[model samples]
Target chain A: MLDHLGEKLIARVSIGDFVVRFDLITIIMSWIVIAILVGLAFYLRRGLRQNIEEKPNRIQAVLDALIDVLQEQLLSNFISTSLARRMFPFISTLFLFVLVSNWLSVIPYLQSPTQNLNVTASLALLVFFTSHLLALRRKGGRRFLKGFIEPYPFMLPINLVSELAKPVSHGFRLFGNIFGGTLLITVVSAMIPLVLPVGLTIFFGLFIGLIQAFVFAVLAVAYINLAVES
Target chain B: MDLTLELGKVIRSINWTFIFTLLNFALLVYLMKRILFKPALAYIDRRREQIASRMEAARKSEATATALVAQREEELKATHEQARRTIDDATARAERIVSAATGDAKKEAERILAAARRRIAQERTQMEADLRRAYAEIAVLGAARVLDREIRIEDHQRLLDTLIDEIDEQALMVKR
Candidate 1:
């Protein structure tokens, strides 16, 4: 059981001539995270334009402060305010989703979706492709294409290798952190029923989870910033 | 547990070409974007704009107030300076009037005193003349009585002269 700590429980479904396999825990937990986010979003949507001015309720205040802080972080990272506002929806959503997903594992009998490489890759590739597409659209086809052969003809292959490595590193970084935490947690829990120590759970689930989520969101914004600027 | 076997499993865990996660995440982003972030960020942006405009208004009002205060101070200072000038002018005019009045009064007093001195001199001359005439008459009467006859003009004349000369020797003027 300790050796098989990282194994996923998969579910298989067939459609026409094809079959699809999904990690059951990740899928189930992904929906739960989505549901929670969606419900909170509905709560946020209520009374948006009303006079809740100066002094807002607790949840509204937190959301307000969170959005403001995130926007400032992007602006401070050297992006224009307009550009930051435009990117706010996507960047902040990523942060919220990742943060919730990372923290979800703190609950008993649950796991963070970030434990899966597939989801991490999806998120990293989202930023990766978004940045490149923005660059292509903004800089035009010729300039964007010429970016690979930048500085010299000899640098093209190196640039391509470096470009290919972005998604891999971006995805793997989160996966490694969350998965390692999960494994340690599992081994410790198996040693003692229900992960009794509690201290280790707090360290991995709360502390590392928050840091990784923050790092992921910031890196996503930075990558997008570089792409648009470059 | 062999690290090699575990490495193989981890490497095989990737389903690189699959679209399930890609679509799901795309949905999540779309929903999350549509639901949560859109309105919240918009509210924040609107609030910032309101704050900036309100501050600008406050600054303009403050500047206007300061300017008004300075203008009032300038007017007050001018009034004070004018009042002082008026008071100084009034004091100079009063002193000039007092000095002119004193000079006029002194001149009038001197003229009255000179007139009084001249009147006294004229009265003294008239009384001396009258006294001599009275003395001449008395002497003529006395000569008439002594002679027991009517007095002659030549005798009268000599008597009068002698009496006048005697009166001159006294050298005293009569008081009223």
Candidate 2:
């Protein structure tokens, strides 16, 4: 079943004795998506006006709707409107990037960056760093460290383990979902090679793609909120 | 036993790569934060501003509508007051006209009564004059009869004098 997905798309780019088979296409595609996202952001920022008489263009309206949804979600869930306003951008951006990357797997002949251990692990690490960074920023270093020893001194090891488990879980969850979905689609396509596999491919591929993206974004926002509050 | 040892060796060998991948992901996230996060935040802020602006515009429009309603009410009230004043003025004018007409009617009636009284007085005076003349004629005829002959100038004059005195006294009594 796993063999049906074929070998990983690896590029043999050698640097002297070290031979690294990096997935160049995946990285390039990710860069492209990131560039487009950045461009959209700049465009929206540029179009914003202090005076409301000028109607928002289509792109600006879409961006506004996205932000509004994010703001409402954050405000309702974990934070005050003011704090949500401050923190929503980071959370929303992380979600959008992860969502786009996860969906990338569904595209024929393209690899999901998240399925790559390096990509998922790196994103997880960033989330890990951000959680700590927010904690330190909000509570100060001493108080942030003190969170590990809550309830009793004996619980410190458990707290530490839990803290360490966050990034590992975060990365693994996304990687496993995309990898599993892709593997399933590949197997079905190989076995049936007809109308039946097409339905399964689309269902598992798109549904899992969307769900994984949502999970990643939601978890990220929740983690950030937790860190900031605790 | 050999397979387990090989697996352990493979795990140990892969650990460095795992570490390297972790580092690479960290670097990528860092770069993404710089390149993407800041702009995305700006976009979100822009979006927020837009929503707030729309809310403000709606509020302002509502305020304007309220002010317009109030102004309209004030104008309507003023118009109502002006209408009331006009009605009152019209009523006062009607009252004045009615009173003036009544006064004119009364004055006209009095003038007519006065004129009628003057006409009656004139007719009474004429009647009295006629009665005097008739009485004089009778007195002349009776005197003639008493004499049993033609009345001469001197007797006639005496009779005339006595008759005139009697007639004057009767007329004065009738008048009294």
Candidate 3:
């Protein structure tokens, strides 16, 4: 119903007061996006060839171009092509998941999972852990910890705050944009409930969805580069 | 207004969804690495190597063809030179045979001419000798007939003997 608009309308499993709670709607939306990406991956996998044709099918060409751009982006940021290849899967998965989740709002009854703080926080946390862990692995714990004291030891707290701020900003950025857009569309639809709101929803939700996905992947790669640099 | 406030609360909430989303993203990355990303990069690398090997094979074949052409050309040149030498040797042999045959013919002709001249000289000398003997016999017969008139047999015989001896002397002088 229109009454339930802008609300994540699904079941919840709550434990003790202020303890752990599970948002079933977020879980379902995430699963749907994951299923789509998996299906697409399988299709692309079936079509892959060692000797790519000069004139490939439409699907092949598009997928190849997507792979090329992603690799180029990674290679540009990272020091080595091997490192780029190693991080490609995680970055691509993050991009596709966010993009799909943000755009799912085009359906009248569906809410984008990225509109939820929990979902965005989880994604940002993954990037956070991955960057630090990889840095620690490559530079060793001593060197990685020592990076905070560089230029001057007085900058240590500032560097630590900045490092901690990465995930918070990364998560909030996507969540705010998507959630704000959804709220605006919900208000418009509540007023008009007609053609104008539909167009506005598509424009803000779909187009901005694509931009947010790209920005998130770019930030993730930049963070990885910062971490990996010795 | 109350519904909008509740929706806003739901949007802001952080719960077990975080854990689920992280698990989902991690699973997706794993599956994609196995099914798509790794294989695609491998395919591209394989394509590069294949193109390089093909170019190398083409270059090798081209070099082999060039070498074969050069070898054939050398063989052809040698064959032409050998043929020319054979023709020159045959020509020299023909010339020598012709010259030797001409010399043998000339010597045979000279020997035949010399044998004919000797035979002609011998026949002429024999004919002259025969004619001189016939003439002497006729002269002796005529002298004997003239002295046959009146004389006894012994005187007539002595005169005949003296005429014959004079004729023999004159013949000897002519022969000398």
Top-DockQ candidate index = 3
Question: In candidate 1 chain B, where is summed lDDT lowest over 10 consecutive residues?
Answer: B1-10
Off by over 4 Å in 3: A1-10, A14-20, A49-59, B1-8, B59-176
- Quote the positional error of residue A40 for candidate 3 in Å: 1.0
Rank by lDDT (best first): 3, 1, 2
TM-score of chain A of 2: 0.85
Worst 10 residues of 2 chain A by lDDT: A2-11
Candidate 2, which segments miss by more than 4 Å at Cα? A1-55, A65-78, A152-154, B1-94, B97-101, B114-176
Report, in order, each candidate's fnat. Answer: 0.30, 0.09, 0.62
Best by TM-score: 1
Q: What digit string (tens of lDDT, one per residue) describes model 1 on residues A116-179?
A: 8888888898889988997898789999988888789799999988877887898899989998
- Candidate 1: residue A90 lDDT (0-100): 75
Pairs in clash, predicted candidate 3: none
Error of 1 at A184 (Å): 1.1
Candidate 2 per-residue C-alpha lDDT over A87-125 given as tens digits, one digit per residue, 9 for 90 to 100: 555566666677777766666776676666656666777
Candidate structures ordered by DockQ, highest first: 3, 1, 2
Question: Where does model 1 exceed 4 Å of error?
Answer: A47-49, A52-57, A192-196, B1-11, B16-18, B101-176
User: What is the per-residue lDDT of model 2 for residues B86-117, given as tens digits with 9 covering 90 to 100?
Assistant: 99999999999999999999999999999999
